[model samples]
Target: MVEKPGDSPHLLVVDDDERIRALLQKFLARNDFLVTTARDADHARRILSGLDFDLIVLDVMLPGDDGITLCGELRAHQTTPILLLTARAGTEDRISGLEAGADDYLPKPFEPKELLLRINSILRRMPAAEPGAGVPKVLHMGPLRYDIARGEMWRGAELVRLTATESQLLQIFSDQPGAPVSRADLVARLGRSGGQAQERAVDVQITRLRRKLEDDPKQPRYLQTVRGAGYMLAPD
Candidate 1:
């Protein structure tokens, strides 16, 4: 049964086809998701600049910038999970989508139920901040400061903007300050299915995150990589 919309996940559906766009929005909205529709890549970018979404449902073939190229561009800055929809179902096409940074791919004419299941599964794997209650809310890492309660990161006096995925990763590391978190564990915690590809994707995210948190991303002091264990966060 499709879940009813309430305080549900927000999704951006990008497609050039007006009918498909409207249909998806209505269908996903009925299934307990906050749905936003965009005509094409440009429209999607404009909407994205103002609002945040939990996931993006992008159509591969569009009038303007293709979904694969757009997905790659977005992945450079945003870590929001993306599911690409394409008519092509070849192995190479699916791999190309993954290479472009899509979290999942769905061929056209797919069951709405399957889409709902995939969305729910991805959301379930995303890491969430644990209840701090009376515990310390502020974590200090040199000039970088993270507030667990607020899910905010600040550098010195400036507030840092983080994508949803980055925030989730920060919360995960902050929860266990100095302990190592294996790549496999991180993949699972981040709402991703286990695999070597996903592990590499996690590494990419960590690299991007380190650029924001560390003075020298090449030799990261705060987010360090353990030899065999995985990665650890050390806040001083």
Candidate 2:
């Protein structure tokens, strides 16, 4: 059985073909995803500017600026996983998409179940929090309230959508509030092999987490980096 993350995973489907886009959105929704649609690259950019998605399903052939270019551009700033959709089934084409920062790729006229499996596979590779006890049920960070038990965050009454990785990071920090956790230690605890590459990946995940948790990511208050140490969660 496929493991469903705590909340419904949010997905953005970008395609120029109206019928394909609508069909994918409905089909993915039926599989327990919170689906959002974009007409093309420009529309996807517009929506992405304001909203955060767990994963993006982008069509390679678009009206303008294709998926490969968009995927490359997005990877520059965001670490959100992207899965490319293309009609071309050539091995080189699939390699190009992966080189452009897509986590996975699928050819046109494929089974929806295959796509679902790919998404789940990508998510299963992300870091997860280790089970522990004595952590507070609710942690206060300015106006944001994180419920550790439920694996949920809220800003006043509005629930914040967190990707699986982000949720795991938060849980890890909450487990040891006010204590520093070294990057290497974080890698070990999150079930990732210790290495420079994995450490850098942890940094990227931290940056993304800050965007959600901090009012100013550049000058973070809650999640702080100790100069020679590591990161500490200072919740009020």
Candidate 3:
């Protein structure tokens, strides 16, 4: 297994076609994603059962089970964003995918760059922060707690250990609360330049923090996105 970089976004690609699967995996990886490829829905399910992913790129047509059914199944348990790929271009097909818990859908014969953009958009919409204003230095949300000034996280009485990057990232979100904190702001707050590498690093830290704070890390409740603005930490 590749040791995922602390900053790279982890993505799972599910497709039956070997050519498309490999092509997408390599392309996404080159674009700063930590890509994992599965040959079919069964393979994807096995991988999903064992590891966590930030998003899934699932082809609507699979070997045995259809992607829409699998999408519904995944949405029932996880909040990770799903982007569906299909040969069908009908509005009804697109709507069905969205209704089945897909965050977005793309018809086949589309550009990979567009897929990348859509992926980023869906991830951006995921909880980057919770809602609150002028939140206290010590923030509480559900079972998780954080000491903003000290850069600490806690789940109930137990102290949760965070990597240095993770601590810094959480602090940035906690400070803003309901306000969206941009990627540039996050880079500057963490004392790094606003380069692609640093931005990717922020992603890694956010993923780690979500795993720690969210009841279901796959579906965050506290940290959410504010559209074009940036990430927000919404505390209870």
Candidate 4:
């Protein structure tokens, strides 16, 4: 049996298929993960409220809200790595999945070994938790102040309530002040599963983040978009 990590890599498996869910949970647990199973997105959401997961395995097809929509919603607040599983193999379908904020996708009936490999790849590629460990780490942008280590955002002395995903996204940009982060790069860096659609969602979050931090959301100076490049958070 694979020994679990000290703070074991917590994985949430969201699938309606009992067979697949059970198999994945057992397989992943044997391979050293601390696995949690959810019958669907609703169940997963409940679990998400209480537990901090390192990664999420979500099925593309569900009874309601579909995996892609749920993934987009999750990305709006959290930067947890997501891997999408689908029975459809169409290029558009795959691209659509990526666009929804999935870090990676696997078609159904895949090899267990391949799934293991992909999971390992995502975990390995996850960004370092602390990019600026020793430097003056408080980020001051306009009226907002963010403590990257605590994953907390504040306006003056008042704490701003940010969803788990928002905090992670802010944590990424705050790490590199004034750096232009590409949409594609953000998708990759954040380990989102969807492709183009996911990038669009990122834009939405940036808009929301800007409104919260900027004096005027329409004319943003701190969070500027680079023409044909991506978004950058420049804090003074």
lDDT scores in order: 0.83, 0.81, 0.76, 0.78
- Give the TM-score (vs. native) of candidate 4: 0.62
In candidate 2, what are the lDDT values of residues 1-236, reduced to their tens digit? 12345498888999999998878887888898888899889999999999898899999998889999998899767768888899997766766775566666788888989888878866764544446777747999999999887777899998786655567678889889999999998877666557785677677768777888899999999999998899999999
How high is the lDDT of residue 208 in model 4? 64
RMSD of each: 4.6, 8.7, 10.8, 5.2
Which regions in candidate 2 have their CA more than 4 angstroms from the true location? Answer: 1-6, 131-236
lDDT of 1 at 159: 76
Query: Model 3, which residues run further than 4 Å from truth?
Result: 1-4, 130-236
- Can you give the TM-score per candidate against the true fold? 0.73, 0.54, 0.56, 0.62
In TM-score terms, which candidate is top? 1
Q: Considering TM-score, where higher is better, how would the candidates rank from best to worst?
A: 1, 4, 3, 2
lDDT of 3 by residue, 110-139 (tens): 998988887886565443444476754688
Error of 2 at 215 (Å): 33
lDDT per residue for candidate 1 within 1-236, as digits (tens), equals 13446568899999999998878888888777888888899999999999898899999998879999999899888768888999986767776776667767788889988888877876764546576558647889998889887777888888786655677788889889999999999988877778886787788778878888999999999999999999999999
For TM-score, candidate 2 versus 4, the one ahead is 4
